[model samples]
Target: MRKEAQELYRAEKDKIVLRPFTAKYPKIAPEESYRIQLALIEMKKADGAKVVGKKIGLTSKAMQKMLNVDQPDYGHILDNMVLPDAAVFLAGELIQPKIEPEIAFILDRELTGPGVTPTQVLAATRFVLPALEIIDSRIEGWKIKLCDTIADNASSARVVLGNSPKRVEEFDLKLIGMVLEKNGDIVQTGAGGAVLGHPAVAVAWLANAVGQFGVSLGAGEIVMPGALCAATDVSAGDLLQASFDGLGTVSVRFA
Candidate 1:
């Protein structure tokens, strides 16, 4: 089941894949599914892919309700999955992509959690950067359960980072606001508090959670806290921008 899922993920890329894991592997434990994810990440590393950072997903209560999950999930971001701020994303290069406005934490120090706190997260954070997470599901029609998505690396695909990062001491993150726009019109608006009351809270959760799996989020690694607002679909010729009130802005052109 693990091997087949990995094959389908690689072959489908951004396209709809046939036969989800749950349909064949009924009653599979979420922990087992996460083990599959870890295996997949190891395979990527073997293939010369570098682990750029980690992302927390379904942290928002809204998204948790949508996905019918009580807890959040984490995924790896490969070196090639990151793009510069304002870069173009070829629509043809991805399967049914969706964009979410998020703030990224650049860690200045290592953190291993079974007890990581939000305050410790902020202290370890080097700065905050505006970000847009591009998520794509390999399953057909985005149909997935928690185990399915977890095995599929939490449905992560690409991330865009603002070139400039603000120091942690420079601002109060809870008050950070973001305006998400498509084609120059605001489509969604939210603040840092929308994500588990604060983005650092989400990051803290990720540290402690992933730590149980023997994964330590290292220093200088970028951590993508959950999206501030709901995700919006993307298509060819679409221009999307996420502007944080004080942090800065990042844009992606879909072509």
Candidate 2:
């Protein structure tokens, strides 16, 4: 990445709570994009931020096709991105915000290596919960190239997890049904298969990808597989709820 582009990227990310840049910077090559991402991570670390987990994006075939990418990409979610139940925020607080239903995994053991398997991910997971991922795009109108999105932490904003949790063995997560509701009305529905054929497979892919960067999925961290369905736009006063068949539900109302 050009030093100029790296500096611009960091400046844009640092404004997460203010006026986030909505326009894409100068086009950056893939290697430069990765460099920009590394710079952002280092900047966050300099600010004493701790990476709590990872989020895999574009895992579904539909998303891949929509983004015109052949493979999945992920981003690091810091400890600050996590919000507890009943958390409130303004709809205008984020730029180009969207919400998606997801299944989140809380791991009981560290997972590393390129050889990690889906079965191992399943075995390592301690619990699963219904989750809503608040996705915010730093790029204008959610317009961005794959490299731009990856460099912006995969558009991650905030994550809300449900109160109820289920053990990995208690549910066929690969087949769990999800219904996304806005204003108490169903807007979209999907199953776990929409996520890379199986949610565990997405987790395995994330573990392998992190390994390539000399990192590993640590114990007690939350890992969110890709969304179970397409993202739904949110507006002020919108009451959003994501109901999972057995894992229970999570909801948030925009102010």
Candidate 3:
């Protein structure tokens, strides 16, 4: 697992793609895959990367259908992965990148669970904000399975967050609408209900999912509840924006 983690870490640093781990180890269980992810995360931390929070992936019907996966995957969010809104990014920084919109939860209290609830999540959350998640697969050709993606940090790459922050009481997250635009054209639209019925439910699911690994959602951490729609391909010179009703908008540019 350490060797596999090393290869993945090197692949990210060198900007190279490799065969999916599942192709090599067909019997790898999801539990073992998460161990590999944790190993890779430890390597990054050794190199000065700080774990900022966590993220849930494949929680939306669109993403699940696109990935052919039925369950959600969890991944750690490194401090470096967080980016400012409206920032310009170099296209070459990642391999086979795609973008998706999410509702981000900024936590004020630690959450641990086997039985975490959405209400508990809201209680611990300090702010709810609009966010864009940039997903990049290290697996060659973006071929991945549940275990493969789990081992690859749920295909996580960069995260761009809007400046607008709202309290949980200020809005109905489950009914909020989101519109995604690429190159000045609307490409996708979805509601918060698309994410496991509600964004907080996704966060609650994450809290319980990672609890088996003895990991807890920490205070002051920014947790992204999963994309509200399917991922969109990105390339050089592409400009993307996502606007959420009542939550303001966030945009990014690829250079």
Candidate 3 TM-score versus the reference? 0.98
lDDT digits (tens) for residues 148-213 of candidate 3: 899999999999999999999999999999999999999999999999999999999999987876
- Highest lDDT: which candidate? 3
Would you list the rank order by TM-score, best first? 3, 1, 2
- Winner on lDDT (1 vs 3): 3
Off by over 4 Å in 3: none
**Error at 160, model 2, angstroms:** 0.8
Q: Sort every candidate by lDDT, greatest first.
A: 3, 1, 2
lDDT of 2 by residue, 190-251 (tens): 99999999999999999998788788999999998999887888989998988899888898
User: Residue 159: error of model 1 in Å?
Assistant: 0.6
TM-score, cand. 2: 0.89
Between the candidate structures 2 and 3, which one is better when assessed by lDDT?
3
Q: Top TM-score: which candidate number? A: 3
Cα lDDT for residue 5, candidate 1: 54
Off by over 4 Å in 2: 2-31
